[model samples]
Structures are given as structure tokens and as C-alpha cells.
Target: MKAKYRRRFGFKATKNGPALQSTIVKACASVVIPALNEAKRIQEVVAYALADPATDEVIVIDDSSIDNTAMLARQAGALVVTSSMLGKGTSMRDGAAAAIQDIVVYLDGDLANLRPGIITSLCLPLLNNEADFVKARFGRGGGRVTELTAKPMLKVFFPELAHLAQPLGGIIAARRSLLQALTFEDGYGVDVGLLVDAYLAGAQLAEVDIGSLEHDSQPLHDLTFMANEVSRVIFNRAKLAGRLHVEQVIAMYESQRQVTAGIDYVLSLRKGRRCLLLLDMDGTITPSRFALELARITGNEAALMQMLDTPHDDAITRSERIAGLFRFVHKQQFEQTARSLEIRPGVVELVNQARRAGFMVGVVSDSYFIAAEIIRRRIFADFALAHTLTFEGDVCNGQLQINSAFLPDDDDADAPICKSNVLRCVLADKTPPPVELIWAVGDNLNDLEMLRLADNAFVIDPKSPKLSEEPGIAVINAFTDLVKLLGHEANLVDQK
Candidate 1:
């Protein structure tokens, strides 16, 4: 990127030059990278961020990649967040929303070329308070869409931004506070949208030269789509600024919803494990639903059937209501029911095989941990995560306690402590799980979250048509499919 294109730049409310450098507290940046199937090089990108002294945290938002991206990034020492298949904009917003640092920098995951000081160069301006938003201008980058669509549209609609070297560049840094305040365009337009939004919001923006770099070129078809999206964003922002008002707007995207993941809680899980394998308890570990079985055993069958037949409530409320039916049910009775529930075939063999192969096998459930533990012992799983059933004396008090591990940062529905959130928070050992994989098995939608986090995910006897709606999740009738997903991890026992 040469200085020939309008050497020094300012947009909207940004001053001609930054006069307020070096007055704030020390800067600690969070590097947020939105990745899809870039499993080939995500580790190096994450490592670069972690190695930088300026980076306080490295977060890779895995966009439902079928590869080992999430597990690998975590093993490489980054806090990994498993996002839905929404797109880059959603990933960016989620990453920044979860950032602990004041400064947030986003880098592309597939970059094969990177200079050592890239992060420092991007953060220096913001660190010293020289600017509120910083965009990276790197040399030797070939951005076909930027040259054709992004720049031309910028020239027509946002001429002040037309001079930017790489308007579509994903490498950008901004004040996390301001980034949160702006609405993000949740598609390929996120980068440019942020640029315009910052300018419109009166941010002091700077374009720093990061020197030579290379990026993987997209296929022609993908490029065509990207160009259209980029053009649309520029046009949309222009209309929002009241530049173009021809009747109504076209292709207006809803503002992105920011999420606050329990990153600290995730980082606090059991460490020093290599691989993590989570099996859903109710249907996978035990053939029958524990609640239904308990209802039958305790003579609360009629009440339990009524509760199940009634319209379902929110998970929290439904859990409470169900526990109310079990009021005065003794712990021993709960354990006895769990113990009596028949185990799925090949269950014991699978756990032993995985554990011997250096994997951490655990039982995952939406039911109470007390019952989950009873199943865990039968299967010999290393751990379990489930809603806690509070007891008064020997009987359930009809109150449930969701562990801090399963608790959400807010009341947001998507933020619930699903299997995905728990996985995002665990298997964070810096060196990694013994195996480089994370395998999860569940019978229903409850395990859908882990499908986003695990390198390999399997659905056992899928209970809903909605489960089939999820792409890439292999549905299996038994542990046979799980072993196949395990894909030849040898069963090697640890020799002390």
C-alpha cells in the first residue's frame, strides 16, 4: 500500500492529525480471528497473536468448521468460541463482545504471510490514544474485489473512504467500546461497514502501513458474490447518511446481536488433558429418559406425563417445574433409578477404548448431575456436566441449581450454558488434550452446541427433525458411528 493515494487521511469527524497520543492507561489488546475451514493455518495465526506482548487474549471464532479448528486453536492457547454458521460479521461481533481487553484487533485466519510486528503496528495507534480506529494497509496484497467493487463504490458513495489501500481488508483494530456501540453488518461487508460506521460516529481513524503480506484468493464465483455484498454495504451506509434516498432501502441487514461468552469460566476448567470426548447422557448413555423413568418409578407417572404433554417452557422454568414433580423424591431413589436404567450397548467398551487412547471421556446431560454421575460410573466416564438437583435432607427440595459452569453471562436465550458453551470453556490445556480431537455425541438438539465446537460430532438416534436440519452432524444409531468418527486414535494406555 503506497502513500500516493492521499498520503494522510481523515473521514467525517476525524481530525487531520492525531494530537492526543499517549494519555490513557496501558493497552492490552484482544486479537479476534473469524475462521471457517482454515484448519490448515489457524494455529500459526493464533500463535502469532498469543506471542505478541500487546495481545492480552487470542480468540478464534470457529464458524462451524468440520475440521479440527476449534480444538487446535484451543491447544495453541487461544480462547475458542464456536459461532453459528451466520458469517464473518456475527463472528467478529461475538469475538469482540467476549474480549477482556480494551483494544480489539481482527486478523484473517488464512494468511500465510505475516510480519512479526503486525499486531504491535496495528495496536500502537490505539494504545497511545492516537486514534480510535485503526485499519491495516499492507503491501503486496491482491484484493480483486477491493480494486473493483469496494473502491469504486466507496468513491461514488463514501468518497472520503475511497483512498483507503484495502477497504475490504479484514485486518482491523478498534476500541472495543466503540466497536460495541456500532451496529455490525453480518456478512462479507463487516470490515467496510465498521469503517463507515466509525467515520459516521466521529472516531479518529488511522491507516497504518503493515508492510508486505499475502492472502489466499477466493474462487471467481465467491469473488463475484463478495463484490456484490461489498457494493451493497457501501450503498447502504451512504443511504443511512442520507446520501442516496430513492424510495426504500434494499438488502438491509439487521444489526448484529453481541454476545458475552463465559470465557473466564471456560478457561478455568480442568487443564492438562489432550483430547475431550463428550457423550450425551439421557439417550446415548441410557436408552430411556431419566425424568420419564423416574416418574414411572416414584408413582408420579401421571403428573410427569402431564408435565411432558403440556407446552414446554423455557429451559430454566421447565427444569424447575419438573423438579417440583420430584419433590420429596429421595437421593437414594434417584440414584437407584439411574442405576437401573439400562446402558446403551457398546457403551463401556467405547469409554474404555477412548480413555486408553488418551482421550478424556465425559458424560454430558441436561438432567441433574446426581443422576448423571450414576450413569457416569456405569460407563466409567471421567467427568459430567448437568443441572444440579438440590436436596433437603435426603429428598430433592424441588429447586435446581445450574452450576456457574453452565450459567450464562446474561438471560439471553442463545447464551445459555449448552454443551457448546461448556466445550468452549474447557479442554483449554495450553499444551492440549492427549489426542488432537474433540468428539461429542448426543441424541437430540441439546448437543447441537458441541456440534459447533467438536472436531467430530455425532448424533445418536436423533430425537427431532430439527436435529436433521443441522448440516454436517452425522446421525448414527449406535456407538459404531462414534468409533468411526474417532478415526483410528490408537488405544495406547499410559505407562507410569
Candidate 2:
């Protein structure tokens, strides 16, 4: 993308006398840019900020960008500082701390159509004593998030500031004193929070037009998280002001509960050799539910319910109790029951498609290894990880041995023996793939953590009520839908 970069020279005092100039200033100003994986556009932005003679320094806060953003920014004559993976708010504050100037101007790094003199326009109001903090208003106005979320919340909580346009614009300039006096929000709420706090603190605020500005919009999956954080900060501030009743607060939480969160399908042309595809065996790959099948076959449906209903401290104890109920059933009978369960439609096709797409498919389940392995062999999966059931002379024993691989490490003892731990073991190989390249498919309560851990997950069973309601997970009605989903992803990669 081409951007306009205007070159301007420093102001020179005439021989006659010093004249009042509003276009240029002699005071020092620090332009701070918070960047993450913005290597393509950071250089242009850094050069633009340094072109102004009033700018004494340019600082780019690298927020743990995986790309070469820091190196490129330094090449463009900007001081680079590394920061934690907290978010943009932390980056901005860290950059401010490293600055030496009293006046600070913040600009985004990923603008495709940024015009000339944006920094000057934002800082001029603050320099002329017309405003304590100035926010930029550019062409093509507010985004969908600002219009749908921030504006309505502002109208209710901050009516006096409702008339302003693009309240969440990141381009801003403020005095050191005013900037230090405000608290920064953690995520997407930072921009709007600063504006609200500044107005409430009795500081003069101004909005300046900086012409047309364009940048990338976040994917739909990320917008859900943004909306949650933005809503949280706004409501917390409202409650602190004593503007909400106790019942109202409870209702608000109930209304906007974040049940599920899905990952963005990032499009990339780079192909890797291996991808860990974790599939849940019980309700996911098979049509019949595991526990229900066991209960029906053993004629102990009431006993199974009693064991399940009894409260336990952790997953290990719960699994032990559930396994103890099947002491009398023979190993052969259990295997027969497992094989009788019908495989979900499109099971083989999806697995084959993933293999052709360069994925190492495996089964990570909470069921017994005997049954999981049987299904794995039938479908020709690469690997299987599950609990081991003990048997002597073809007779099933009451004792159940939990898979050591599923156990949590010493650092986190309380963590459940969930599929995520199995995933961790898979990733501990000599050449493990990054989390972004991993994909998961599962259905049930135990699969929740694993679904959240993978880059993108598919909940392939419609009967799973708990998993279906969760946000961020892509809940599909049938296993056939996965073929289409993966095909779409492949097409996107091909286009890129």
C-alpha cells in the first residue's frame, strides 16, 4: 500500500524579528507508536513522524511482535523498546516511560492511507493552549465496533461527550501531566477510557480533523473479545460512579456472558510439514455417547448417575469413581460395545482431507485406551491417548490406571487431566508446530480446555449442549461440515 509522506523543514526566524507562527513549533515533542507485527508499514510511519522538526524523538513500542517490526523500526531512525505481551495499553505506557519530552503524540503504525501533517494537526491544539488533550477525527468515520458498542455505552454513561466523533481513535496528543493522571484500559478499551476519564476530570478536550486515515480491521472472532473487554471497563466505571443498582449489575452480567470464544482463521501461504489434529473419541467421532452406552450395557444406569452426581474435588477422583462402576464388565464385552457404536458420517473423508492438507491426525480422549485404540485403528489414525483399563484373564478389573501423559505437571497440580495436557505432550516433540498451526475437533465438557487451546477448534456434535453454547468454538451440526470448513480454509490460503 502506498502512503503519502510530506517533507517539511524547520522554521527559521526572519532577520527583522521573531514572528508568531501557528504552523510550526520550537518545543520538543515525542511521537510514540505502539506496533505489533507491522513491519510493512512501521518504516513509513516512523519516517513521517521524524520529518517534523518539532518532534524531538520517535519511540516504537514492540509488543512482542513475531515479525521483524522492531528491527525495521530501528532502521528507520526510531528508538525501539521491547515489552510484554499484555496488549496495546501496556505498549503505549511503556513507550511514554522511555520518552524524554513533556508533550507526547501517539500514532498507529498500520495505516495504509495516512496523509501528511497528521502529527502536527493532533499536536497543534495542545501546543496552542486550546486543549489539554486532543483526539484525531479522520475521514471514513467510526468503525462498526465504535458505532455498535462504544457509542451506545457513551450515550448512557458519558452523555456530555456523546457529540464527539470517533471517540476510540488511537491518534491522540496530550500533555505529560494530563497523561500521567489517567488510567489505561487493558485492551480495546484504552482509547475510549482515556477520553471518558479526561472529560470527567475537568480537562479541556479537543477533536481535530486529520484527513483520510485507513488501516486493517480485526477479524470477527477478535471483535467478540474486544466487545467483552470494552463492555467490562465501561460497566466497571459506571458501578464505581454509583450509577447502577445491584440487581441491574447482575442482569448486565447475565445478559452479556461470554460462553464461547473462537480463534481467527488467519490466512497464510507458508506451508509447514506437520500439524497436530486432536480429535475427541467418545461423543465426537462416534454417534453413541460413551458413558450412556456403558450405563445401558451394564444394566447400572442408576448406579452410573449416582456416581456421576456425587461431587468430587478434581477430575482424577471423578474419573476413578466413574471407572469403578464397570468392574464386573468383561474386556471383550466393552470392546464389542465400542465397536457397535456407529461412526459419525464423513469421519473417513475429513481425516483423509486433513492428511492430504499435511496434518498428523490423532485421538485425545477421556475414554479408555482399549476403546479409543480400537476406533483409532478402524479409522487409521496416527496416534491415540486415553486412560488405560486393567484386566486379568479376559475379566475386567475395577482398578483404572490414569494415563501419565494426561496428568498435569508439578507447576500446576490442580489442573484437570484434560485434552490440553495431551496436546502439550504432542507439542513437546523435537520439532513441534506452533499453536497457530494446530487444529482440534472435540465435543463434551472435558474437551473445553483443549478447544480453547488450539488455534481453531470444531465442536462436531449438536447434542452437546454445553459445548454448543460456548463462544469462540465453531459448533457444527454434523461431521460433514468439517470437510467444507477445512476446504474453505485451504482456498483462502491458496488465494493468499
Candidate 3:
């Protein structure tokens, strides 16, 4: 359950200090996990990525895995993509190409005991605009091949990079732009190749401490093959850099000859509607937050403000507390306010078109299901998922029932009532055909998880400008853009 590799790290950058912009502009990242047949460990690895606040997107690049690596990753809320070829380097390159964030991180699938802040630590330098590329230095010492082969070779050939603690470490983060401009080797040489390319690209690189990254070490034969491949690439790069002579090239080829066999490049969720589109009712479908509207109209705005000012006791407790504020509100007034809220333009058409395109369109809200259902029918969605409010004698009874769909599942039992959990409940149904694409739209912090879980996400006028830096999330000002996006995506679905 824990990684054995551990090592200390010291950052050399003197230019930028700690990330003060973290409060306003998050250190958003797109995590690219190059996995191959790593079924047992892939799900946990993806979960580590998903749990990070900085990780807006978790992309699992399946390099023709034989096991359920891809399926488990998808089930764990990662965006899975099949590699064009069966190589870690190809997966890395393709993952970078697919990433839409400013920072792209590559994580080996087999790594274990990954700290929750791993991505944030790897990305902080880049977020503060200090480093162009980052390599993770774990607590454990170097692997056999790293010590016997990579380090010695780097010392001889690329002396400038000889100081790197983990030249062969697979945990790396770099600006997407930098990754886009670089090339990825298609074998065991990929990690070293990236280091050399980044150095050659004149990227300001930094290494940070990611404590206790442990994994099963490669066997002697596998280590031999890895050392051969790694040395081969380093020599090739040295030759390209004109740092090697005829004798060194001959020595490299000699080593290749010494190694008789080549290495195989390796390393390496859900049922429901064939496709699902979840729209957040408050700001997503109604263009305005229903809670704020209700508070203002009922003259209980201060009570609602108090709700925000108070620390949440627990999700259920918070829901009950907020529902208590509506005790003075009558059912008729609630219905009137829910019905009076204007639906955003193009929602009906988007929902309808999405359904026709094989998507089960629904509205998932943190607010009451009654209001959500009202909005859902207004847009003609298939269903609505939200908390339920009780009534007694035509007035709210100050008791709230959380939607089962919003409650935690077996994976995260103690977490808050998140829309993403509702999505999981829907996708977990075995009755529906396999889901093709999950499209989601939302507007605020509450909706962040839902958007992240969705394959295609649209954030309506995001409050935090940082959302724009996240991958697989689009910030839209108007509703018409969503209509167009759905139509285009629908065409792709139809073509498929």
C-alpha cells in the first residue's frame, strides 16, 4: 500500500517565492497517467489524482492495456483515452496533446502511497511562474537502473543535468506548451529523453519533494533491458548534442549488442445511460441561483448569509440547518419562486438535442428536488436529482432529505453531498447501455466536482478565473455557445 522509494529534495530557484496566487488563481493541472496493464493499482493512482484540488482533470492514457486498467480508471472519474500505439512515450505525447490545462503532469501507474498534495507540490513552481519544468524527487533513493546506469551516463554525457536527483523518475510536470514543443521517446528511454529534451529546450527546471513514492522494483533482466534502453537514448542525445565522439557512439552500439533482446514498452468506469448530460439547475439552467432568489424574496437574506458565514457542521447538518431557514416559507411561495425563475435561453433545445443524440439529459442540483424538478420539466429533461424538502400544512417543515444519488457511495463514504456522486449513482446503474460521453454544465464551487467528473464540462460564467486554467472545463458567458457545442458533439456521436 506504500511506496518504498524515498529521497530528499532541495529547490534551487531563487526568483519566485511561495504561491500567494493560490487563493485566487489555483494551481490547476491536467494529470496524465500512462498506464499499461496496471489494473490492480491504476484505480488508486487515479483516485490520488482526482483528490487533488489542483488536478482539474485526470486523464488515463491506456497503452493497449490487457487488464481492466482503463475501465477502473474511468470508474474512478478519470478521462480515459486509448493510445495510438503501444508505448509509454506515445501515451505521454498523446496525453500532452489531449491536455487543455496550462500544466500537464505524468504519473506512472504503479506508483503507490502518493501524497494528496503531490500534484500541487509538483505544480507550485510553475504556478508561481518560477519553473518551466518539474521533476518529483521522492524520499526513497534511486532505483537500481537509475543508480548503475542513468546517473553514471548523465554524468559522462550530459554533465549539466548530472545533478538531477531522479533522472529516471517518472513523476514529472511541465507547462503544456513546453511538453507540446518537446518530443517523447517511445520506450523505457522516455523519462531520460524528456529530461534531455527539456534541458536542450532551455526550460528552467526544478525538482520538488514528493515523499515516499514506492513501487515494486523491476527484476534483474527487466533492469538490464531498461538500462540498455536508457543508455541508448542518452548516447543518442549526446551524439545529437555533439558531446560524444566515434568511440562513445561505438560503445553505445556495443552495449546495444551486449543486450540481446529488446524491451516491451509496458507499465500500466461505468454503466448507465448510453450517454448522460447533467445540468445544474440553479445557475446552469435558471441563469440565477435559486437559493439567493428565495432568500431575497422571503426577506431572509441575512439568515442565508449567516448560513454561509457559519462553518459547515457536516453535509447533512448543513442541509438541515439551511432547510430550517425556509420554515417560514410556504409551499405556494416556494413553487411560485421556483416557477418564476427564468430558464436560460437554449437550454430546452440543448437538452432535447442532447437526448436525441443518445444522452439521458437530467438536472442535478444542490437545491431542493422540487425546484429542480420544476426547472427540469421546464427544460423537458428526463429527470432531476437534488435534495428533497419536506412540507407540513402547506409550509416547509424545516426538515430536509438528501437525495440518495447525492449521498456518498462505497468509495467515498464520508464526503459531502456532491453532484459528482449523483453522477456516479446514475452511471452505476447496470440497466443502461454503456455510457459513451458524460456532458455536464454548472456555474460555481459546488458544481466543480460534477464538472470535473464530466467528459465535457461547461461552467457558466465561472466565479473563479482559475477555472479557465483547468482542463476539460469550458467557461461560457452565454447559453447559445452550449447549444452549438452540443450540436457539434452530437454530430461526432452520430458519426461514431
Best by TM-score: 2
TM-score, candidate number 1: 0.45
Lowest-sum lDDT 10-residue window in model 2: 258-267
Q: Which portions of model 1 miss their true places by more than 4 Å?
A: 1-27, 140-142, 245-496
Select the stronger candidate by TM-score from 2 and 3: 2
Best by lDDT: 3
Residue 407 of model 2, lDDT score: 77
* lDDT per residue (tens digit) for residues 1-496 in model 2: 0122233322234432111232346546899999999999999788878765557789999998999999999988899998655689888888777888878999899976565556666777787899998889874336556655665566666667767778888998988788788888779999888887888788999998876676777888988888777777777777766665565544343222111000000011112435557788887899776666877888978987776787654667877877888887887788887788888888878888877766667777787877776787777676667776665545667777777667777799977676787667555532212333577888777788888888778787645687777787888777677776675554444444
Return the TM-score for each candidate structure.
0.45, 0.47, 0.46
Model 2: runs farther than 4 Å from truth? Answer: 1-23, 245-496
Query: In terms of TM-score, how similar is model 3 to the real structure?
Result: 0.46
Q: Give the least accurate 10-residue stretch of model 3, judged by summed lDDT.
A: 260-269
lDDT tens readout by residue for model 3, 179-285: 88887898899999999999999999899987666676677688888988998898889889998876554443433221111110000011133677888887678
Model 1 clash pairs? 22-128, 266-425, 273-433, 274-432, 274-433, 274-434, 275-433, 275-434
Off by over 4 Å in 3: 1-27, 246-496
Tens-place lDDT per residue, model 1, 1-496, is 1111112221112222221221221337899999998889988788766655466778899999999988888887889998755789989999989999889999999986565556767888887789999999875332556654665566656668767887888999999999999877877888999999999999998999877666676877997888788777888889889877442222111000000111222232334456778888888788899999999988988987777666656777777788888889888999899989999888898888777666777787888878887788889887777777655455677887665556554646567666676675564333223335678888777778777678777787788987777877777777854565443643322331
Every candidate's CA RMSD: 20.7, 18.1, 24.4
| Local distance difference test, each candidate | 0.72, 0.71, 0.75
